[model samples]
Target: MATYLDTPGRVCRSLSEEDMELVHALQINGRASFREIADVLGISDQTAARRWARLRSAGKLRVLGLTDPIRLGNSVWLVRVRCTPDAASSLGKAMARRPDTTWVNLDSGGTEISCSVRTRSPGPEESPLLQKLPRTPQVVDLSAHCSLHVFFGHDLGPINKRGPLTAAQVAALTPPDTPDRATDATPPVPLDDSDRQLLDLLARDGRAATGDLAAATGLSPSTVRRRITELRSAGALYFDVEYHPDILQQSFRAALWLEIDPSRLAEAGSALAAHPEVAYATATTGTANLYASIDVATAQLFYRYLTESVATLPGLRHTATAPIQRTLKGPGPYLPTTA
Candidate 1:
């Protein structure tokens, strides 16, 4: 167990305000080229490329395809908890190491620690996903909320004409990367507006059958299937489930945030990312900035793990937690529109 006194044994820093603005632009549309970001941020494409590279080397960002779990036949849950004022945060931080958890936020606004979790149920007849919650401790309060809507992924606050995603939501969905993109170009194909309409249908319902897709897309079933296949092959479409733990019976989740010494960031980040209970970790720019999402069975189980497992982690000190209400979105590339 690492003592609180040794907190921030290493430090991880986020981008500057200028960098953050660029990030917001890129995050709003990962497909945006350095040229696009530079155009928006009023900088040269070379400068944008350098800044993005720096952001990645700092372990501060990622860009992947985000998916919806409901269409994939999964469940979602929100777990909120409270622990000893001193113990509350540390407990949350430990459980975040678990793979079962997905989103973690510690000491969010003021009162509670929260985590939003998504789980894949074992079987339609078997509810191993929900029944599995009580097996762990370190949770005090657990509640459930539906992910009614997903307004935006990168930034959730209000939007206006000046906001990046406001007037151009759909147009902002797909992006074109800068010159040094991560991969080589994909071979081209022939899919016209009708084919695009088919894609739009699948976007709303990934599980839609070929016949249904064809009907909605105004194409032959075979053509629809071929195009869909091509899209999936081209890395454009994916299918997966989103689990609702509360409905399935496992509503326990929480977000854990840790503050570590700047000197120990690499070691600490690597160690915590590989922790047993932690699900997600983000190195942010604030006092207690290391954020992770965790999941556990019960408050008692949560307690045992914290006191026994995470309490002793090296290079860790101060901690905080909050109960998650819902997964704003499943663990896919949380992206804005292409517009």
Candidate 2:
């Protein structure tokens, strides 16, 4: 099947110090010129450009804008799912393909899968993802919990952070007067095991060579090259970036867990998912109907989002904020590496 790689957020398995620095530079300011990044790292512009191409081509980096969903008028939900052991992967993939889904992950301890998605209701609403979900046939029973805030969106995008960026990288990455374009949809493609392995390599070390991927996947260098060509053509891969939330002055990021009527799930969830501010939204089964995270500049901004933005959403039962303390990992945690 064809897979699209343009999900709202991104993540990597691991990164080196220099790679982290590069990710930081882009996160702080994505529009930085090769020359500017070079200056900060004390490298040449040509070198910066070359390394960037490698990372970007491999889907180890991204340059996209993030907005606060509440500001865009949306409610949130967190879903904990209990599925048949054999049904988890199929169910998760189905959810991931939805336009409203922002993040999807499975935990090993149980038959539970967790997902977060956003929705906007006209007068406090339920998420639509639930309706579509039961119809898909992979899920058994679902349980949902509303979120007050995101403890951290670890594994969402590139970069590991305890707090804000340091002085130098931040200075280099500060958002430009004009930022990079943020598009949710992109092309699609078929991915093979070799492509997966190559993507894994770049996720950890962007500067890794084709020969390295060739060796890792047990394919000839030429075969690895062919698969990468297909992955890029199909849009199943993108680069990893070290985004600096502080540079954008986004000191606050939170999730609001909400409950809504199942009948109104589709209507409410669709509206919320369309907003630019919503990182991602989804419908799930259980106690709380929906969950999502938002990014904003300050406490006042958060209020505005709540009062004006979220107030207007449909099917909203309960809405409260739980702010993230720290992100232990990005949205997509690293896959285990072999060889």
Candidate closest to the true structure, highest lDDT: 2
TM-score per candidate: 0.40, 0.46
Off by over 4 Å in 1: 1-21, 39-43, 83-90, 107-112, 121-130, 135-141, 151-339
Candidate 1, residues 103-188: lDDT per residue as tens digits? 44454432344545665542222333335434446445544433322222212111111233333442443332211111223333
Task: List ranges where model 2 is wrong by over 4 Å.
Answer: 1-14, 122-126, 134-138, 150-165, 176-339
- Model 1 accuracy (lDDT, Cα): 0.47
Q: What is the C-alpha RMSD of each candidate to the true structure, in Å?
A: 18.0, 12.3
The per-candidate count of clashes, in order, stands at 75, 67
Q: How do the residues 1-339 of candidate 2 rate in per-residue lDDT, one tens digit apiece?
A: 001132224332344566656666665444467788888887899988887787666645545323333333444456656678887766666666554554465544335566656676422246678656665556777755544333223212313342234776665555323222222332223345655566656545543566876778788988766665454334343333433222333555565656767777667776665554555455655545666566666778888888887777787777755664333223333222121
Decoy 2 TM-score against native: 0.46
Scored against the true structure, residue 267 in model 1 reaches a CA lDDT of 59
Error of 1 at 102 (Å): 2.2
